[model samples]
Target: MSIWEFANPRKFTALSLKILPTLVGLSAVLVLGGLIWGFAFTPNADKFESTVKIIYVHVPSALMAINGWLMMLVCSLIWLVRRHHVSALAARAAAPVGVVMTVIALFTGAVWGQPMWGTWWVWDPRLTSFLILFLFYLGYMALWAAIEDTETAADLTSILCLVGSVFALLSRYAVNFWNQGLHQGTSIPVATGGRTVADVYFLPLVVAMAGFFVLFVALVLARTVTLIRERRLAVLDAQEARA
Candidate 1:
């Protein structure tokens, strides 16, 4: 009935077991297929040329990079408000994925930028905020690791998430507020894209985005299950000690 029913460990575990395999298989197929299509089938753009192929991975990685942090923020809020263990663990599960995606985005952006911008890095507003977001991910995870009490770790990490959210929001919109960056304007919407890219590129990019999204979800769910099982084992151990 209530969506919270899934928060129960048994329910979550059972449901996740059924769905995760499908998600994983679908993601692998889509990601691999999309990437192959983009690289092998799609022609080079007149502007970006061969470098345009990177968008298959770059755009999807960037999308997941932002969405992963947003997912953590939402999960953290739910943990704080509703005291859901799943919510807290879900936030924890998301952090490493977010960090990896952020790094991938930055790395790919640098690779893409070198030929275009003639530089590997810059302090442009968008880039700076994105770097800040990566730092926040590290700090959030580090703070969680430092705290010994699970509940305390969750509470502290949740607060850290709230603080870092300001930078995350800035990272998303900084391109709009300060358009002076070396990076080009948004282009995914096709309409807002200024007709810059060809339609042939859109289909693979869409598939790649969908694949990465599903992969991100699968990873989070898998990690959450591991965390929940670890927590359950700890509880059992404590009970055994008392017995």
Candidate 2:
């Protein structure tokens, strides 16, 4: 009944495997549909013109990149407090996904920014913070790969994740912190009940963000399942060698 019950590797693996197919299918449909609608059907914006279309990919990915690190931060805290191997492994699994999302965001942002900002890159507060978050992701993954002991690796990486979260938080809020940045305000300001983007672009952008979130869940679950199996296999191999 409790959500924590699913923290057990066997239970987690079984449940994740069961839902993964649905998640995968839904993500693909939503992502493709949203992209088609946003890119093909929507008219150009008054200021940015066609370049504004990249929001379908850029905004979602940027949101995911920040939130993915937050997810890892939560997993890391769970691992630290509960000493759950699954939590640690989940954090590890999410790093690559987070990093890839960060890359896509950075690249797409550059593509979108060139025309608007008159340059490919700038040391804007938000952009700099996001870049720091990406570096932290790389460092976390490398720490996991470098340590031989699984528990030690998990402990270290969890700590690193905790530290990296500062950058993640900054990445999401740096634009607000510094008004001088070239980066504009949020496109979909749900909190304020007003949207800067028009309805045509807003609808598809929402769908794309939803799709990205679902895709992230599916990927993290799949990777965690694989890690659980690999850990079991390693234990079996160790036992056989001992025998």
What TM-score would every model get versus the actual structure? 0.96, 0.98
Tens-place lDDT digits, model 2, residues 119-166: 999998889989999999999999999999999999999999999999
lDDT of each: 0.90, 0.92
In the order shown, the candidates' Cα RMSDs to the true structure are 1.6, 0.9
The reply for model 1, stretches above 4 Å from the true place, is: 190-196
Error of 1 at 53 (Å): 0.6
Model 1 misses residue 1 by how many Å?
1.2
**lDDT, model 1:** 0.90
List candidate 2 segments past 4 Å from native: none
Q: Highest TM-score, which number? A: 2
On lDDT, the leading prediction is 2
**Ten contiguous residues with the weakest lDDT in model 1:** 188-197
